[model samples]
Target chain A: MNTAQHGTWNRLFLAWLVAAVSTLGALFFSEVMRLPPCELCWWQRICMFPLMLLLPLGLFPLDPRVVRYTLPLALAGWGFALFHWLLVLGLVPASAQPCRRGIPCGEVGIQWLGFLNLPLMSLLAFSLIIALLASTRQKVSP
Target chain B: MKQKLLFALAAIVLLLGFFLASRLHTDARQEETRQHTALNQANLLRMHSPTLGPAEASVVIVEFFDPACETCRDFYPFVKELMAAHPGQIRLALRYSPFHEGAGQVVRLLEAARRQNRYWETLETLYASQQNWVQHHSVQLDQVWAALQGTGLDLERARRDMEDPAIAAIIQQDMADARALRVERTPEFFVNGQPMPSFGRQQLRALVQEALRTGGN
Candidate 1:
């Protein structure tokens, strides 16, 4: 009802758009590009993909209360993406890879600039989306 | 103030994406151009590999396949169709990657058959009847031999040559080369040394088309 909460709509919608793109990107790599998704990547996707639908429903009426529902999911997705990136970077060990397929999860099918891969890109995207959502929550609560 | 920060970060994400897309586009173009030059001007054929097209063909498909791989069996007809359709314009250089149990022995037999000039027949027979020899958990060499009984191959000489160190060495070389190219799965392809960016017959066909555009018929 107040001006402070009015612009939470911007943050919420943009974060939703990012989550939407992230979901589609994951599908594009797996389905279109024929790259297999690792288990951790799948967990991150499980956490992130629902936001694509849930956030928009929250935004239809521009409710600041959406933070109660979205933040936890964003946080969880961000955690998974961070862990997956760590596994891909070899900052963690192979024993931690957690997948037993013919192809290893940490296998660098696409490496760029010596430190960037799909997982890292995913981590960065979720982090931004989370930051935006949390900022909206800060303005929304009191 | 919050909106400003959010929009600023969003702008950066969008800009980073554009930068990556443009850089990748340039890199792919450069790489394709490099391969086009090699295909047009150089000879990269493997003299010992089994082939299914004319030597003077402008487009060449080099496929690394395993006889026992289910995916390779699935792609067999598609690769055949590509060759059949293009006739002399598309050539396929078949490389062996024996990924399953006893696949190396079968590859050895194929090589041994090559010595007797029955390479194509043996490959066709093995692929056509892949189920008889390649089992769920094991390979039946006797069944494979039985399948080859009337194909006019000298079974005794094939058995002897299968054990030959020279035959073993070729298998070793092909495996080494596949690893160097990071071929993780069966039916991996390179069109005139242009690697498919993804796994699909359509990707292979597109790369072949690109190569033919440069190399010419």
Candidate 2:
């Protein structure tokens, strides 16, 4: 394999590892810590869960062509995570806010273990995936 | 070729570092807010019960609850489970606020149930069936009358007590206590006289454990 091929494989593996860890970390935080997730957090989780499988599927064919398909998934996940993180940080107001009934999302403990809210962690994971997909690009003929 | 890999790795490291730094900033801010909330809780607890706990208990949990609030009903089971698990180590006090309209009767029925040594039972039953009464236009004497039937409560006395000035006074006192604490919600709690900033069972347990370790008042 050439240097570029080797680098692509390395980046893909690293990205998948990050995505897996982030997803598992989120599960542990919610289940073990008993931290109930809010609605936006739930949506972000839904968006990320599929990528956990999709990214690994991309690796099976070892085709750079897979990057074209995976890139959209990465971008979509990143968009959801970005929106959720901003909602958590009060950067953007939450759409379809779910606080009217029970413990408002804002009231739940944010930034556990120094600084990891559900959304920020999701953002980190999505960002890693995007970085990996971006790295796979080849220069196009003009 | 090696330089590119190193660059990619470096970028990853940098991004992770930025994420960690941002998280730390938010955590520090939340910690400060928690400290201020704790101080406010301390003042409120002092006004209500200066000593904090029963003379022999290991921890004290003070909850400010509104009878008609849906969230309070949702949180009731969790609190009950905590109390059951801790038993003698945990002392609990329920302060009532009739924040929602027509909650006064429910509060009175609860107090009457306490008089009969069935406070926990009736409280649990009421919470389990809160949906029935909370949606009604009026929870006056009729609601209390209906709630007492088949709950093993003395319906006649429960209804009589609903109109008792003393019952009204107790409810008023609870509202006053809630106001002093700056409790803005239905199910606010204080562990060892410190405001509970979060509602998860593990978080509540951790707070209680911290109080026990500190030899809480």
Candidate 3:
């Protein structure tokens, strides 16, 4: 209702939008395009998928405490995405790859628009969501 | 206020329904692509590749593998178990894609094992102890020979046959087929002439199961 709360709500909503879009994009790649997610990808998905719905549920009446609940998920997803991106870029050693059984984490299955691969896209999505959530938290605290 | 909240929920539900519906069409679309490629690219899928399982099995799994590749070694037992689990429904054709340095020598050794009617045994032995024989993505021929010894292969004869020009030609042909199929990595799989929509044991299993359901026709 207040100006600060209204602005925080906007940030929360934007973070929700990013989560929603990222969830759908992940589904499109895995379900529609039939690209199987690796172990790290699955872990990131676990963190990102719930925020899509949770954020909106929090926004229905505008709960300021929502940031407390969602921030951890976003941060964990960000970490996984960052590591996956590094692995894809060959910055991570092959010996350190976590996905030993199924699709190797290092393999770049789908590259879009010439340069953007799945891991990089995931990292970007998580980064945006985390950034939005961080700003929302800053406004909600005081 | 309640109407606005309901509307948003409905919109999300609608989008979710659309994605779920699209999933039903995915298999058909993939099957179409598989059939098209299978028909036009039969030559690329088959060669003098070594095969396992019954000759008339309906489902054929064509695998492009590097003998020295760690992932390929990791998958060998799993593939065998899958074939066994299906009981005459699946066949496997293995093509060499010796991408690792000095891997061709291992492939040649494997080819020589075929002459003594011990191809699969030798391959299994080598894969089981692959970590001992492959170092830093390169094949250690002496270690590989040591590993193969347990398979009862005549090492002297195998060494002599490893130099046979025919073995080199097989590797050359397989490498060419690998290139033609755009295989960039080891352990690439094609079930019933359909490359995995993506890499993963689960994906490969699903493709194989689908092929089995269709009787591979």
Model 2 lDDT per residue over B71-157, tens place = 787777777677677667777777876777777767777777766767777877776666676664345545545665797877677
Give the lowest summed-lDDT range of ten residues in model 1 chain B.
B36-45
Better of 1 and 3 by lDDT: 3
Model 3 segments beyond 4 Å from truth? A1-7, A23-142, B1-29, B44-47, B52-63, B68-92, B99-102, B134-140, B182-217
Off by over 4 Å in 2: A3-45, A56-69, A72-142, B1-34, B41-43, B46-59, B65-91, B97-105, B112-121, B124-147, B156-191, B195-217
Top candidate by lDDT: 3
Q: RMSD for all candidates, in order, please.
A: 5.9, 8.3, 7.2
Candidate 1 CAPRI assessment class: incorrect
Model 2, CA-based lDDT: 0.67
Show where candidate 1 strays beyond 4 Å.
Answer: A1-4, A17-37, A63-69, A82-96, A102-142, B1-33, B36-43, B53-61, B82-92, B99-102, B115-117, B131-159, B176-217
True lDDT of residue B101, candidate 2: 76
Per-residue lDDT of model 1, residues B1-217, tens digit only: 5544654576567557755765676567557645654554332345778888788888888888898888888888888888787778988888887888889999999999999999988888988889888897357889999999988999999999999999888888888777666566888877876777667888777887788779853
* Whole-model lDDT, model 1: 0.79
TM-score of each: 0.66, 0.50, 0.59
| Residue B81 alpha-carbon offset, candidate 3, angstroms | 6.9
lDDT of 1 by residue, A37-106 (tens): 8788788888888887788777666677777888888888888888888887789888877886566778
lDDT of 3 by residue, A1-142 (tens): 8889888877887788778778877887787765788899999999999998898877778886888899999999989998998988989898888885558889889888987998888889888888888888778766
Best by DockQ: 3
